[model samples]
Every structure is written in C-alpha cells, then in structure tokens.
Target: MSLNFKDGRSDLKRDSLMAEEQALPPSYSVQPPRQEAPEDLSARLARLDLRSSVKNGMNVSADQCTAHLKLLEAFNQLREDIGQIPGLFGIEDPIFENPETPDTHQHVQSPQALAKVRVAEKRWSVYVARAVARFEKWYSTCVPATMGGAPCNRLTGNQFCTVKGLDRVAYHGLPIKQLTLPDQLPPLDVLMVWHSYMLNPRCFFEDCFRYGKLDFFATALPWTAIDPYIDIVTFEFKPSVQAVENFETSTGLCWSNLNDGMEKTFSCPRCLSTISVPWTQGSLWTIANEMTPGNGFADGDFLAHCRVCDTKITHDYLRVLKFKADVQAFMSPSDTPLPGTLLNKDGQPGKLTVLGSPPESFFPNSLLNAGLSHRFLLLLDNPNVSMSDVRSIWEQGLTDKNLVHKAKGVRTRLLPKERLSIRRMMSRYWFNSSPFALDLAGAVIRQGSFVEKMHNIDWLHSPALKSTMERLVQKYQRFFTLMAENPGKVAVPTLDVDLAWHTHQLNPLEYYSYSDKMCYGKYIDHDDKIEETALSDAFTWTSKAYADKYGEPYSECTCWYCEAIRESHTSKLDRFFKPNKVQALEKLHGVEVPSDPLNSPHISAHNAVRDPESEAKQRVKAAELDKAYHKACAKAKKKGKPEPRRDDYFYYYAWGYPMYMPLYYPYGVPVVGGGGFYPADPCMVNTGAGSYGACAAGTCGGMAAAGGACGGGSGGCGGGCGGGGGCGGGGGCGGGGGGCGGGGGC
Candidate 1:
C-alpha cells in the first residue's frame, strides 16, 4: 500500500547489475546494437508486407509475427536470468490455480508456484529499471541546449529542473524562450538573459505574476534563488509621466486643471468667528486678502486674526472647520469674500469653476479634480477593508443630507410613533448592542425618533448639520459594536474618517447607486461650459444603456436629473428582478401567467362556462400544487432519491426527511458563545436551544459546509452523505459512514 523510495533494495539491484555486467566473459559480453536513423527505420516500417500476412483476423505481417515470437522467447530468457539473482524480489507466496474458488484447490502449498511468483517479481523489477534508464536518456536530450550536458543542480518551485553551465544556467522543461548566449557570458548578461526570458512574450510575464510561482524566485542562482529579485528591486518604483497621463485619461480627469484659484472660509480659533480666505487653488497657499494684503503663507503655516477678538487660527484648525462647514453656504456669496466664491470682497460675483456650486453636475470629472476619485479608488482596491464599509464612510462624509432625505425629499408629514414602530419591527430587527456581538440578537432597539425628527423638521435642514450627524451616527454605530464584542477593551475601528469625508465631499455619487438617491443640480446662475468629451466617451464606452439612451456619439451632459435617472433605471435590482421574477412565475404558473393571468383567453377556454370566483380558486389550487410538486422534486434531487408521485405527497410530508432552513448568522458572527446562530426557519429564531447546543444538534451544518466552523473543518456537516462533524468529529454527522452520531454503518 505504500512506496518506500529510500529502501536499500534499489541500490543493491544497481550494484548487482553492475557486477554482473563486469564479470561477464569476453565472448559472453552483450553489446548494444548500432542505432539506425529515423528516416531509414520509417522507410523499413513502410515497406512491411502487412496486407499479405492478414489472411486470418490478425492485422500483422509474417515478419512482425516472427519478431513478436522472438521477443517472447527473449522475455522468458530475461525472466529466467532475473530468477537466478538472489533476494532481488521479496519472498513470494504460493499461487492457486483457481483463485476465485479457493476451496476447490488442495490445502498443500506448491514450491514450484512460489518459485514462479519470485521469478515474476524479479522480471517486473528488471523491466522497471530498464524503462527508467531509457526515460532518463530521452530526458537529457530534451533539455535546453545550455543545459543539455550539465548535471541537474536543483528543482525550482515551479517543478522545472535547473542546471548550471559556464557562467549561465537554464531551467529545463520550462515553457520559455531559449536565450542566445555568447561563448563567454558574464553574470550581468546571465541576469539580463533571465530577465528577458521571464518577460518574453509580455503576456507570459503577466500570467506568471497573476497565476504562477515565478514570484518565488527573487535572486541570482547559487545565492538566493527562490524569491523575486527584480520585483523587490523595483517595488518602490514611481509612476512615469506617461503612466500618470494614462491614469488621468483612464479616470476621465485632468490633474493640472485642478489647480485653478478657489476661495475657502476659515474660522477664528478664539472667538469661533468665521472669515473668508483666498487660496491659490491647488497651490496650498492660504491668506486673507483684506486682513493681510499681499501676505502669502503656506496653508500649513497660515494663521488668521479674528476681526473682533484678535484670535490667531492655524491652518490645521481652519482645514478641519472648512471640511465641517456648510458646503452650500460656505460657497455662497458674502461681503469681503474669497476669490473663488460667487461674490468677491467688493460684493461682485466671480466666475464659475469645477469645485463651485452644483458640484454634482461635473460628476466624476469634478471628483477627480478635487482628488476624491483617487482616494475612492484606493479604498476600493484595498483587500483588508470591505467595500460596503468604505461606501458607508464615504456617503456619510461627503453627502449634505441623509439618503432617506435625498431620495424622498422634504417630509412635511410624520407617522405616529406607534405606527412607525410596527413598520420598523416588520422590516428591520433593531438590536441594542452591536450586531457583531456573540448574542443572536442584541438588546438595544432603534426608537427611530431621531430619524423621524430629521424627516419632519424643516428647520434642521442645514447641509452641514446633516453631514455632521451622518458621521456621528456611523461612529456611534461602529463604537457600539466594538464595545459589545470586547466590552472593557473597546477600541475604535481603525479608519481615516477625514479622508473619507474629503472623498465624499469631492464625489457624493462614488458610494451611492443611482437608484438609491438623486444628485441635486448646480445652484449658481452662470453657465461656464467646460468641455468633457472624454467623460462622455468613457460613459458611452462603459455603459451600454447610457449610450443607447443618449444616442451614438454621446457627450457628457450637465443635467444631474437625467444622469441620476439613467443610473437608477440601470441599478442592480432593475437589471435582475424583472427577468428572474418572470422566469420563476412562468415555471410555476405557465408562460401565460405574465402577459394576462386574470383575463387570459387560454384560461377562459380551458375552464369554459365556469364562474370567475371558481376559476380563480382553481388557479390558486393549481399554483399551490405546482409549488408542492417542484419542492418535492427538489428534495428528492438533493437526497439522491426517486421523485415522488403527486399521490405520495401526504406520505412524503409525514415520513420523509425533515426540511430545515439553511443555517445563517444575520449578526455577522460565525459562531456565538459555543454554539451557532440557527433560526427555526429562515426568519424565526430558536430561543430554546443554546448557541453551542444548536451547533451540536446539527443546526449549523450548512454553516460548517460554508467554512464557518470554529476550526479547520471540511466535508458535509449535517444529515447528508459525507457530513462530518464541523469541529472535531470525522465523516458525516448523520450518515451511513464515519459521522459524529448516526445509525448508518461505518
């Protein structure tokens, strides 16, 4: 049952073969025959008189038959020669003439039979040895020219054989281009050759990085040959100008145009009074033109003296306030204002810009100009963070209003608390603590009071206040969850809230689906046309619906409502629900169900002269029966049993296997305490069984199968075949084999 490659028997066999060849007498010595050229052998095989020798049923020439008989004779001689060698094959047992009917044979063992078995085993060993020698010779010839005659030094992680020759080395059997080496190549040349070989046919190198073990090799051979040396050296390489330009084009934005001068509002540190400061757009220079005329300072070092209280406010404080300020009001017209604002210091309105009022009109282009797109892309690319989590942060940080407010508009009326409570209870299961806690459901319940107030209160409509509340709610939610999980050791979730805020401020649409909320249009009065052909081209290329809706050669439109509508129409649910729902309904009630279920002529003709109520009842009954039939079929398919007939429905439901809902943890915890979160049904929880006991009772079987077990568990986890206990038991939990607890045989 086991193969021992390190056994000394192979060494002994080699020694014996060498000794036998050496001891042979000069006349008895066997000489290898001269090899014939491939062409000559092919010609001889082609000339064979195969047709003449096929008189019977055998398709072979007389000469071939004669050669086969000779070969048999030689094989018998070889077996005899091997039998003469002592202890080559282990001791053999006697052979029975009738293996199937052992009782028919005599009880006495035959010495001759044992001898034959020993001879057979010896013959097998000799055959294997010869085959190995032939294969090795063929392999050496197949190796690359650079390593043809060289001894194999090592095997690479990718399984290629490596050999050194002169100053260079080659990997044999690897599907790479052969390097053209000089008679005397240096180490650097060898390195270059290897680099070229690794990169040959560009796609090869890409494939290696994407899906192969080429990343394992790092250094020059004979030094550190199992790691990626080139990658390590160039790991910190900066993007070239061309690369930057390519990135800009890909994102549909121009980096240089983001530097246009803009106005920013800053707050005084002492009195908390606000002031307007003119910034040289992307230059990082911030100074109040009226307060300190012609005095320019780095944004980081810029300080402002309060007009009333004479308090100096640093740029850092001002930056924080700036992000927290009301986006609309901060950019609104003001006396003694910044240059980028609609109104300058003299009270005259200024020119419109990308980052100005109605920022959503420019969309992705405006976002890129503000550097929000770059941040969002980076967050999206990170593996450690979840996209949903990043999206939540981005939405909160950037948006002026909550999603509900944006989607539904101003709510003039409010539902009573009692009515709202029932609706909330039906739709959402509110928890006291974080859902990530070990408990199946947390203790806290969301009263929806704050949400209701926000919905009804027209006075609480400041965009700044909404943005602030959004951030506070998110923070509070995360903090509550962390506190519940660790209690006394609560730690804030690691996140760059400020960065998320900046990203959101730049592009609110980054984290929202078009259907989720609509973007409000620009508020400014002026029309400053900035050509966005690239944006249009990108939108057209990326979205088929956009192209179709706008017509060919579509250009980016500044109409926010149109874009929002397009996005919402093409949302996830819009794309999938109609087709899937239709398919399911058709499979249940027949194809006619969709076009005209109530007034179909087919239904009317099928039940001719029947009353409308009776027909309706019959249709309902038929639908129920179809569902039951499908359910039975699906169950049979899963259990690998025969399908049940309609007549057997009662018997099947009463005595067949119990149907259980798939295990799930809505709170996100894989396991709570010592058990798993398994509800009685999909929506109802089983409060009687403890978490650990539920797992033991096989409730978390599906969870275990989905890699949700506490330890390394594979195989099925519950009642089906191959259901091994998720944590420690072997085989399936309730099956005919090595399961945790079952009535089946092992």
Candidate 2:
C-alpha cells in the first residue's frame, strides 16, 4: 500500500455495506444517560461549591467539615446576591418586574452592589490565591529545579524539547542507536508497530487523565517501555514576589549502557514524508565495529526537522545519542524560594543554575496548559455574554488580527455528507487528538507572545499539529489499498476482543511489548474482531506508580481530556450505537416528552414560555481580542453573520459538540472571515498562536474527575493521538501521535 502524504482523501462510498463493514469500530462510546435533573439545580450551585471538590475530593485534608461549611456559606452568599440584584436596581420585586426570566441565569454583575459585594469579592480572591499557592507548594514537593526528563523544553507551552540529541531522550520506543538485530518482520506487525509508535504521545495524554498505566490500559505496561510522558509541572507567583523560581524534578534517563551500544540509522529521505513501520529491516547495519547487513539507507532515506532551529537535516547525517539526568524539588508557599532538597546544590537545583530566569505565571501557565486557561479568562472578562455570543466575539477577534486565512479552506471535502459515515467508518480516525491535539495553539492561550498576544501557542509546529505526518500517511495507504481492492468499500476498524482483557496501555513510565503468547490476533485473515473493553468493566486500574506520582488508582471522566472520552469517540458503533435500549423502551413505553429540548416537533410550544430577551441580556464581550464568539449559545440562540469562510471538515462534530465545551481549531491554519461564523477579523490570530473557537474554549471550570487526565491542564503533558483510528484516508489527518500540540520544538 502506497501511503501518500499530500492531501490523501478517501474514495470510499457511504451507506455501502462494504463501506459499513470497513467502517465499523468495536463499541466504545458510553455517554451519560440523559437524566432529567431539575433545571434549577445548576442555577443554585455556586463557584465556591465547585471549588470544594478540589479540597474535599481526597482524605488528604482533615477539615472536610470546615470545607463543607465554607462552601455552604459561599452558596448562601450567592443566593443573597441574587435576591439583592433587584434591590440594587431599586425595584420592589424582581419577579414582578421581570416575569419573563430565562430559566438559565448567567453570572449576575451588580456594580451597584459594589458596596455590599466587596467582602465576598475579597474572600473569593483569597480562596483563589490559596488554591494557587497550594498547587505551587504541593508541586515543589515532587519536582526539582534542574530535573532531567522534564516533560517539555521548559521554554514553550505544550511543546517538549528532545533531549538535545536522539539518544538522550528516546522516551518512546524510538531506537536511538545505530545497531540492529537481523530478522524478517511481518507486514501486519509493521502496521501495528507504526500504530504503537504513534500511540506513545496519544497514550501519554490519555494516561494523564487516566492517572497512569493502571487505569490507562487494563493490564500493566512493562516497567521500562519508553512510553511518552508530558511534563505536568508548572508554577506561577504574584508580582510582589521578588524572585520567581520555576522548579522541576525528574529521574528518567539512560547513559553509558544505552548510549555506547546504540548504532546510527538511515532510511529513505522521503521517510520525512512517509509513514514508517517496522515491517521492514534496516537497509544496513554495523555492529562490533563491522559493517553488517546491507549498506544503510542513503541521503534520500529521510528528513530530520529541528523545530527550534527551524532547520531540516537529511537522513544521511542523522545520529542521536542517550544522556539522562536526575533532579529533586521543593517549593515555598511564601515569597522566598525555599532551599531546594537536593544536597548537591544549595537551595538552587541542578549542577548549573541560571540566576534571574524571570517570573512565569503558574495558573496562566504557558508551559503545559491547553485551551482552558485563556477561555476561562474570557468567561471572567465577559461574565454577561451569552455562550454563543462569546464564540462569535472570539472568532471575529481572531479575524481582526488577520489569523483566519489558514483555516478558511472549505471543509466541504472533509467528511462531506456523502462521506460522513464513510469517514466515520474509517478504522483509525482518532478525534480528540488528531488535528485538534496537534493544534495546541488552539488549546490554550500562552503568555509572552507578541504577534499573538492574546492566546498564542508559540511552540506549536505545523508538522507536529499534523502528527509529523505519521498516521496521515498510514491511513491514506490503508484507504488507498482498500479502495483498490474493494472499490467503494470502506471498512470499520474494530477492536480486538482481547484488548478488553489485557487493556495494556502506552504510559510514560512504561512501553508496550506485544506479548507473543498473548498476541492481538483478533483481526486475523477474514475475521472481524469486536472489542468489549468499554462494555466490560472487569479490569482494575491499580497502579503503584500512579498512587505515588498522582493519587487515585482509577477514575472515569467524560471531559475533553479524558482518555475514555478520546477512546469512546473512536468507534462508529459507539457514535451511533444504542446503549440500554431495552431500558429506554421500558421507561418511555411510547410516552412523548412534551418539551424535549432535543425533540424537533415541540419547538413552537417550548418557545412560548421562553424569554425572548434572555439571550441578548446574556451578551457579554470576550476578553483578549473581542470577537463576538458567545453569540451562538447565548440563550439568545443568535446567529452571527455568515462569513465567506468555509467550515472545518469536522465542523459537524459541533452538532453533538458538548454544549459547554470549547473547540480548538486546526494549527497553522488561520480563521477565514465571513458569515455563519464570526466576522472576518484576525485579531484572534494576533491574539495567540492560533485561535480557539469560542464555545469549545469558553465553557470551562468543569470539575476535573479523579480519573480524567487529558484536558489541557498538565499534571503531565496532554494531547490525544492524532486520529481516533479510521486513518484509512478519511482526510488530511491521522489520529494517535502527538497529544494536543505542544510548543514547536520536538
């Protein structure tokens, strides 16, 4: 199968049984049953109430009782504020003056209540300050300033810098040396090998949300499998702090034994543009100071791109080495940098300490945070704006900065109606991490960007965003071959039944070694393997590594960063499959919902009681670049003027797009100006590395579940693999490989 890197599009037909067979995925999606909770339940909750989860979530704090009391007081404070809003307006009765109130009330801003609100505002600030302080304090407890094996370059947000050389930082199963063992490799295994190789980064993101390997996969990963890991440690301090010491501690590296034994390798120069699989052996090898196998691959073997130098090296001269470092950490809650724990250096970390590195913000972290940081601030800035209007404002802001042109290409070719199901059927289409993850610029806004001052992803790489062309070429090849053999048939990528049993995953502390005796042979010749990992919850997410490093053993989170969220969306069966159908039937018994928000026919009567101005009143402006981004969801259900721009290939994902979540757009791609979206402003672009679509980026502060690891927040590096599988030529994308994009340096 020839894997073409340039614009490889699928040729499979949708609705065809053959395509259906090709597109079927092992069931994975398991969404929350639509529980009809009272609409007022959310309205009654206060931000203070949510913050308590962070405190009382674990037994670590002995004052659960106190935390509860504080939270309730916060809640009462909110209620009082609501009651006083009318009084502040000098109205005798709020309900009588405004009988047509929208069921969903937004954050109420009563500047008139300024005199009465000061105390609460101050308290809220204090609470936030303490949380930030605790996070920093707890962080220093585990990380060292000069920590080696830090998850990233330590310079850019979401970007990881290679260990200066290949040998020193082969975190994945990348063989950094130039030696090899002779053997004939299987083609299928080769494909599988590439898939596993790509899984390194994706699994890293998954595991972060998943805690570690225990919860990530059903089985434990080999103790030393070179699984990819994201550096999750970042800290910030107030301006008053005279000195800022960003600390990191790590102890993962290989020296003499691994480095000296490694041999140089070469491959087709086009490998840069090709998908590499282990199906084939090294064209050449040298061991024991002798030329072994055939001569190594020539200069045409591959291209090595240095993200930092922006330099490309021909494969002919690519040689990487191994060098690892170990460091310890300690942080002080007070202004002064507490003496570091390492006995080697006095207070400072590492052998070489650079004085005056300047202060970096831990909360508005530029190192690892994805989209949540800036979008959260957007909400704070535009407390009055409706969700949809905020999106419009945000999008338009990007246009004013002239950043949308890159993304303006029509998504007509990407998952068009005729190909929607076909694309969905593609076996390797990973949704959470594919283009979305690679486009970390869209994930969160970082500090220190001048061109993109709003929310920049300066370290993001175009190739990385595209998963370095890894899965893209592979999927294209499969689709190409399938099209050649079956014509219009697109096959669904099913999971191995055994995947549920072993549930082994690629985690940073471990690498996956395909057990020969326990092979994933479900997809043998002419056989369809249906995986049941999601359906069966028999396995335990037990991990000593996670307990020591993070805390929880296993947790199930449905948020954007959740690996379960990433995997759940992988299968078509999961996408359209009916779960608990029998239960649904028994409960409904043909009863009709008179006012289902999701039901189409009940719209007329539903609107009669709805507030007409609920949306407009909610229209608040977004901070950073003010692109009317929140217009869509603003109780207003308002529509932005349609721009001349084209929707993304995956725009329809928005239909089922969770209401409160934000959507980060593709990287290197600029937003186009026009209608059916925000105006053609590009300030959003200049505002950051790439622009984050308003809604997807906006709705945040959602509680992070115990097991959730993949959201932009980094306890570790985070980004889903490029595709949700279904790589077979679905589009110019691949799933797995490179979690949501980090900074540019690789």
Highest-lDDT candidate? 1
Candidates in order have lDDT scores of: 0.22, 0.19
Model 2 TM-score on a 0 to 1 scale: 0.21
Q: List model 1 lDDT by residue over 236-260, tens digit each.
A: 1122455345434443333222221
lDDT of 2 by residue, 1-746 (tens): 11111312223232221221233221111222344652332222111121112111111111222222222232233323433343221212212222332221223322222222322222222222222223323323322222122222121211111112211121222221111111111111111222232233332222221121112222222211111111111111111111111111111111111111122222323233432221112322122211112121111133344343333443212211000000001111211111111101000011212222211111112110223224434443332333234334333433332222222222212112111111111111111112111212111111001112111111111112222122222222232223223211122221111111111222222222211011110000100110111001111111111112222111111111122212222222522453333233223222321111121110011000011122232132112101322221221133242221211222111111111112221111221111111111111211111222211132111110000111121211111221111121110011111121111000
The local lDDT score (0 to 100) that residue 326 gets in candidate 1 is 18
Which regions in candidate 2 have their CA more than 4 angstroms from the true location? Answer: 1-203, 206-379, 385-390, 397-502, 506-746
Residue 9 miss distance in model 2 (angstroms): 31
Q: What is the clash count for each candidate, in the order shown?
A: 18, 149
The list of candidate 1 runs beyond 4 A from truth reads 1-241, 245-324, 327-634, 637-746
CA displacement after TM-score superposition, residue 258 of candidate 1 (Å):
23
